[model samples]
Target: MPAAVAELSPDAPAVLLAPLLAQFAAVARLEHVTRAAVELGMPQPTLSRAVARLEQELGVALLAREGRTVRLTRAGRIFLAAVERGLSELERGAEAARAEADPTGGRVAFGFLHTMGSEAVPMLLRGFRADHPGVRFQLVQDYTDSMLQRLREGELDLCLVSPRPDGPELTARRLGEQRLRLVVPVDHRLAGRQRVRLREVAEDAFVTLEPGYGLRRITDALCAEAGFTPRISFEGEESETLRGLVAAGLGVAVLPPATVARPDVAELQLSSPGARREIALTWVTGRPLTPPAEAFRAYVLSVRGQLPLHS
Candidate 1:
């Protein structure tokens, strides 16, 4: 360790030297203790003592007197260079922090399920931006569990999730529920039906989102309620991919209503009572959001029953 770090008292962390560093830098820049003191709005004697204290803390001689003026010694020049860079970085950090707090122009770290990316999320974002165009969003598309984990880790400010996650750690608002459909290849026998019972497909091979996804869990539960375990033939991370697999007749899938029409598959309504997944806006229960995040949350809730659930 350098002499300065070695000499510091346990309670006097290097952070405590911040003000003294500023004082020292001003003095070093002016090369005249009295004049630097005047520019710094402090008495010359107080400035002199602060500079001395800084030197003592650093265990180095930083200045030399010439007549009534002062000059930085070689050590002072080197230390000043480092201090100036550190101060500049700290200033930049402060500016970024302030910018994040700006209500109209700040950034919001928003997360949502991949299922919503096709339409619902984009629609919400477009409507929110219509009124607050300057606000920026950092969007994360993820599974419900992963998104909630990021929310807890401070990586996400808000999320639109399904199955309405619950716990002491989360705050969730029910936005509205969207109907889940049973999608089948167009040539399949049941594809001609406007609606079908969940149990009707009990023997059909299933294509689904992979395990750990909220929709997957819902699919499994609905299948169990329908009195059979789905024999999943293919699993994927995205709902669109599953839809495509269904189109290829790989297997049928349970999915949210499609935003765009796909002539290759037919979407049928479920006769099951709970074939719907609830959508919610979620965040860490006790965590305070930045201004932009809070604004976006309020805007989302304001639209409550108005989310574009279908294309």
Candidate 2:
């Protein structure tokens, strides 16, 4: 072992160096024992001993004494950079802990697909906020896969997604299922029908979301099962945009039943083997949720019946 690292015994517990690290950080910043100690609200000798102990623990001399002012050794500069980041992270963690402990109000980072934002999410949040008026929410709107990625990265506490994400790293609870309807221009021939089979649309052009959205995947699967690849006329990000295109006689689209009804468009039931998308609340397994997040999850589960869906 290097002499600097060897100064501290190999058997010494790693946690014991925390205070010395703080002390060294202070001294390294001031480059003067008396000033660092004054800033730390400690005696000069005490601060001096702390730095000496840190050097001994690391088995290296962290500082070079030049009569009065001390300068950091090469190893000391490298160690200081790491310590700054680590200590900053620790300080952030402490602030988060305090925020989570606030009994009056807390923040929840909630995520959901763009499709649900129009009606479903607004309804859910409205009811939740009535009871938890003090609680604040940060809304993240994205497609299914992107939302799941954010959940795993700890950016989102939980997400409202469709088709129920499947992976060992994620845990999902089905809230309810939203039946997809076939939308067509009001004057289109199929608009007069109450229901139609997927194969009936084989000859029609379709408007759909771009690839990567769960709805698009469902659209592709249904078209494949219907024995024909859809003739896609338009690709978009929002369901409302797809609706507008369908209303303008651009092409037909498959959208959730709760989608906004336009005078120029007609929504007909589309029959398929699995004609519905499952809406679920998904979170990363083994990651702990904040108290407010946990409470909101329980509340949402209890009120699944009130959500927009077929009973």
Candidate 3:
């Protein structure tokens, strides 16, 4: 909280504008006054006072205190929803202003999952940079959930993610689907098959991604649907490690076609209904897309035809 926010009263006219609304939204998001204060780089007390003043002006208690934790009241929940819409609109306005000032030269931050980091990302960036050289790109690599959260908080302009939750605040466009293949050691009996059924591989030892990773969940679901539980051999995060384990004859693994792009591993198509994962580009709905983000999205769609899909 700062001295200025602390001094604000319910009757102040400035409380009705965008800045106060942004502060209220941040406080609502963090819940803790201190954490919200830290995010805003203001004194906690000042942030608390600003929220207090906003609540006063609205004639509603925005938050309910339970011990040290704060939860939103009904009015607060409603207010927060409105604040999200308002803030999104404000962001769009700012973006529009920036575009008016300079249509092409602006900074944009993008985040993507590790799975898409190698070829897809590079291709998209290269095509975008070729078209809009003046637009600066800031790339971030992170897991799916963290990337989505950052996008919601306005820290990222765009993100590439798998199918997940959707709401009025966010929009998604399909990039394309990637086939999930079975990777086995070269000397393994299954390696000679053109395509192996899931049931055939059900009893085989498996190395897979750790829980919370997108591919892990997909593999688990596919195995379950095939009426067999995978024989767990090793759990890890990186797909490269999983592939290496398979190549070393430790166990078999399920991965996207792109995962086996290297020549070291053998990729076999899975039968009994092969599995595929959808990839998409997502951003906050109604938020104005920066030139860089728009260009990247366009390039991804343009190149999507080249992506492999299950027959």
Best candidate, lDDT: 1
Residues 23-82 of candidate 3: C-alpha lDDT, one tens digit per residue: 888878878778888899999888778888888777889998776557899999998998
Q: List the residue pairs that clash in candidate 3.
A: 1-42, 1-43, 1-44, 1-46, 1-47
Residue 252 miss distance in model 1 (angstroms): 0.5
Which candidate, 1 or 2, would have the higher lDDT against the true structure?
1
* Candidate 2 residue spans exceeding 4 A from truth: 1-96
Per-residue lDDT, model 2, residue 235, is 99
Error of 3 at 56 (Å): 11
lDDT of each: 0.88, 0.85, 0.78
lDDT of 2: 0.85
| Candidate 2 structure quality by residue, lDDT tens digits, 1-311 | 32344455656645668777888899899888888999999999998998888888888998999877899999999989988877875764664677677745788899988877877789888888888888899999988888898788677889999889888999999998888889889999888999999899889999999888999999999989889999999999988889999988899998887454578899888878577899999998976677778878888898988887552
Candidate 1's displacement at residue 23, Å, is 23
Q: Stretches of candidate 1 above 4 Å error?
A: 1-101
TM-score, structure 3 vs. true: 0.67
lDDT of 1: 0.88
